[model samples]
Target: MAPELPFDDQEASTNLPLATQIFRFVVTGVGSGILDFGLTAILQYALGMPAGFAKAIGFVCGTTTAYIFNRRWTFRAEPSMARFVAVAVLYCVTFVVNVGVYTYLSHLWPETVLYSLLGYVIAQGLATIINFIVQRTVIFNIK
Candidate 1:
């Protein structure tokens, strides 16, 4: 038999309106993005780490934070190993895409702080969109 969840099946369903979900997602994303961007900036500029490495570290940190909040607050879902594994797979795909986009844009653009920020935005924006869609329709779709 499957293990019981902390919440009942009814409670596990994500019934939030789409607008509310998107708003909460944006708020969560902004908080996560700050941590990501700050860590990347510090590692790359202060410690002289490579851009890709620094961004990878930052992305991991940010995504971990996002998963926690998105699961609990945004989706209002109980914990499940299946959901966890699914999200892990999704994040792995996004990780490659996010880092690849950032690396390519950083190389293509002139080396400037503004351009670096733009690259981060573009990469993060794409990743966020993908994450929201998959998480809503697949991983967190308790219905």
Candidate 2:
């Protein structure tokens, strides 16, 4: 049985349908991605920070945003320390995969704006797929 929620139905997060979950995940990811890119641009260009450092900071920001929204709306899971740890570990893996793809692509192509965006898209796409599968099947499965 589901645990009793000491709040209204609106405040409780029930497991959503698959279609609804995908829709929510896309929406949440896009929003987080925009913030990530914006922060990366600001840190790398405006502040003259290194790309690696700036991207690291941006990735953390974006991941944090995604986690908060995904927890509440996408998976509708009640928060737990174990869940948080699982997500953190997942993010660590994704971070390397995402950045590694982008870095390899950047090296292959000239450092043009188009290639940069292309690299970001490919890396982000891979990470998103991994994130959704792992989160739905593993971390958030209890919900």
Model number with the top TM-score: 1
Please give, for residues 1-143, the per-residue lDDT of candidate 2 as tens digits: 23222222555354667887788889889999998878877876688876667777888899899998888777788898888889989999999998788778767887555776787789889999999999998999753
lDDT values of the candidates?
0.86, 0.80
- Residues 48-138, candidate 1, lDDT per residue (tens digit)? 8888999999999999999998887777778988998999999999999999999899899986668879999999999999999999999
Candidate 2 at residue 102, lDDT? 72
Give TM per candidate: 0.89, 0.86
Q: Which regions of candidate 1 are displaced past 4 Å? A: 1-12
The lowest-lDDT stretch of 10 consecutive residues in candidate 1 is 1-10
Best by lDDT: 1
What's the CA RMSD for each of the models?
6.0, 4.8
Model 2 lDDT vs. the true structure? 0.80
Clashing pairs in 1: none
Model 2 stretches astray by more than 4 angstroms: 1-11
